[model samples]
Target: MANASSMKIRVEELESGMITAENVIEPGTERILLLRDTILDSVMIFNLKERYNVDEVYIRKNFSAATVADEMRAEIDIHQSLSTLKEVFGSDEDKPLTEFSKEATKQISNVTNELITSLYADDNILLKMHQLQSYDDYTYKHCLRVAMMSVTIGKSLDLPRNKMRDLCEAALLHDIGKRTIDVDIIRKPGRLTDEEFEAIKKHPQNGYLLLRKNGSYSEEILNGVLMHHEKYDGTGYPLKLRGEQITYLARIITVADVYDALTSNRPYRQPWSVAEAEEFMMGGANTHFDYDIIMAFLAAFAPYPVGDRVLLSDGNKAEVISNNTNVLRPVIKILTGENADEVIDLYNDFKYLTLSIKCLDKDGSTGE
Candidate 1:
């Protein structure tokens, strides 16, 4: 007889004669043994006795835990940076654009580089980055999220370092013009009136002016600010540059902007799920967004995100344990049956079982 601690069972090893335990049943112990086929619901554990009969039972396997502390720390740092930006922007005293000073820019740039390096070290950071809240300081948070998301997508596309930094800077300053807009309109919880929206629409041009006024930013950076809103189909605002006419940095920032807008909760409505937001982008592909950038964005993002619990197609609850080798699907551990507390590698087994993620449970932590 195998010792409970060392006992290993394969999926194929499960059979009618096997007796399972509510927990990890030790050998030579008097724990109740539950029949395999008697299991019901999903992702749970049950004890069975020797007299019980079985036909079929689902058993969950164990999965390794993913370390997400660094990811969470990165998220907190990003949020803090945004908060600082808002405080600096909202002061009653008008600091001249020239007074904006290059030191702060240098500090932001250094932080950006550190953040990119941290995120690249762990793919899990991408999901945690998405969970950042858009507070009253939406402008700063929006800029940071855009910069991070753009860097993520750009790196996935293998853009060179110089170009990626340019993209990051562009994303960071994409909404600098919002400083010139009325705060009430920018933060209004309801649908904007035409005039209000028109005011909001002027941000791109305003941002371009502000950056040019500083006289420190390059034309590449300024162009990114002016054209980030341009759509692939020429339906977007400002200059309405179409498709390839939009700078690559602008195109990248556009996707990031749309993604952050959809995922961050607003006073008007709750944020969309990561999967839902990605689907929205899919619907807009080739029309509102660049197709390849969208693809790269999808590859770099976790729809369900690690650490979030989800209900599986098999009617079981599982925690996302790790990202799958394939970007679209993640590996989850069954947390609820005879398989309760076991890890399931959906990527390896579900191919034959036709299993897929059914729904996400919002209650669980995204683990770090």
Candidate 2:
């Protein structure tokens, strides 16, 4: 039997199953029992005849004799409790902000990993865009979106995986300091005074200190929080480190942060169109952002994402149903006077095409 530190079991080994209580066993307790490898694939828990929710179960040295029926019962109880918590805390009415914070942080990490992997393979951008659009709260959604965009940009630039993960973690935690800022300042629907703006600027330091106090994150993560606002031209705040003095991860994150902020609806201003935001970023390149990172970002972002409806230059309407192999061109489903879902491959039909995204609708749906 493998020790807990290096426990190994195949999916087939867990077919018969064994029982182990995650909570009942002490932290250092080392008892081996036959268990389904749920950690390998959490979805497998639903397939098991018996369920256990204590913590985790491990395979034992015995060949084939173990009972997991009781364990499955415990799992059901735990799952029920979790479901209750989700219903109560995740309700639209008035859930506590603390609970929301925890859930948001968890989601940020999960989405960051997904986004990083998606940059290498062009599969899930639409799903991710929809997930981002569904969140009602701006802070959580903004942080998660920025982290995703930053990780995508990093991967497009061919950064190493470990470095990219660190950047993602940093990007996810970048705005955590906002929790320390005054609620009034953060939620203000109008333009702030110079003093209020200064107060808001302190969030990076506040976030860095909060993470430091927690004593769990690495220095690079903290630095990312501290320096993400710094600019290439040395006009940024706090330390004001310019050019190469700022960390590479921080540089990448800054571009992503600004792009998301501009494109996302805020209390003070309507969200800018993706094309408008792209133009703004292009103008800021080399002065506020690293030019190469900007190039990578433009390649990664979809100005007219799939599933969005848009109005073409010819006055006909269409829905963007898919992206072309190249990121610049997308496959749009044109909706003319009588036809719907007429797939138009922009790459092949360039001669007759002069369409552009006017703006993103409230649901991020487009028409052209």
Candidate 3:
């Protein structure tokens, strides 16, 4: 999307004829009250003041509401949640496992509350999460991203508010069992032996037991943590629960967890490209993951959206005009080289079969 020039203003300062540059959401929930480009009138402004807890909104800075298009984009702030997860999940040789469980339970509750609210407001939150690729403190950031994606998938299924809260919390702590394992086995540079791999597969059960002992988490949260590793085809570890036998939240988290792992920058390997990761996820439906959750995953993740300037593998820059049946292979207008301004359908065209997008240019520079 084209991020239109906008300025943030207080709700009390809102005036008639002003246009919203972003979706306005309900406080601490997934409900949306107004969409981007909604022109404000006196009645709408009054309702916002009397009924909603919204404090501020982004409005088009230099254009008339009558003429301006809603080319603006809103994104969730992940840096704060990342910092909080680091605080809860960060390695501290001195911190005891019991203390870590208690602390993580408390902090994750607070962070995921804010995540649910912000994620629903921005339709492109999954794309933003994809851009949060970094190499430092992998576990902390991975858990946070998993929580984000799980909430997004839940929103696509229209999960209830309480279930959404539990889903986010469970996703955040799904790997808590790893803390109880020996550090050597968890961080082994090479492939694990059969015995060591067996120990490694004990994390989900370990996480479930640790949190259940605390008595602070719900059964939904506990089961989600335990069964998140379960597969739809009865091949996963800790338990071979198949199909609907696995909890619904766990199934959702399973899809989110695998996608984040595949795309994350791990110390041992390079991260997969967005296109490759999505293709892999699509191929996992009904075996590695549930078909419905996989569908939600596809609906939530749009690595490339309209108006994005992307770097193609062929050493050219292109502006995404629209996504075809296959979102990763979008119709693009070449912005450089002899074919400048040429629009190519990457999904249907045969000559451009070898070309693919490498990554996006996320410099925050507005106007192509």
Question: Over all chains combined, what TM-score does candidate 3 have?
Answer: 0.68
| Model 1 error, position 257 (Å) | 0.8
Query: What's the C-alpha lDDT at position 319 in model 3?
Result: 84
Number of colliding residue pairs in each model: 13, 17, 0
**Candidate order, TM-score descending:** 3, 1, 2
Alpha-carbon runs more than 4 Å astray in model 1: 1-80, 92-104, 117-124, 127-131, 134-136, 187-190, 305-309, 312-356, 361-368
lDDT of 3 by residue, 1-368 (tens): 34445667889999876766655666776555554456666666787778877887766678654332221222224566777887776574534355355676678888887788776666445544643555667787788889888999999899998999999999999998887787778778898999999998999999899889988999999999999999999999789999999999999999999998987766666667566798899899999899988887886676676766788888888888988757788999998788989999999998999999877753321232
Best by TM-score: 3
User: How close to the true structure is residue 211 of candidate 1, measured as C-alpha lDDT?
Assistant: 74
lDDT of 2: 0.61
CA lDDT of every candidate: 0.66, 0.61, 0.77
Flag the better candidate by TM-score, 1 or 3: 3
Estimate the overall C-alpha local distance difference test score of candidate 1. 0.66
TM-score of each model, in listed order: 0.65, 0.56, 0.68
The top-ranked prediction according to lDDT is: 3
lDDT (Cα, tens digit) per residue for candidate 1, span 159-185:
987887778877887887877877677
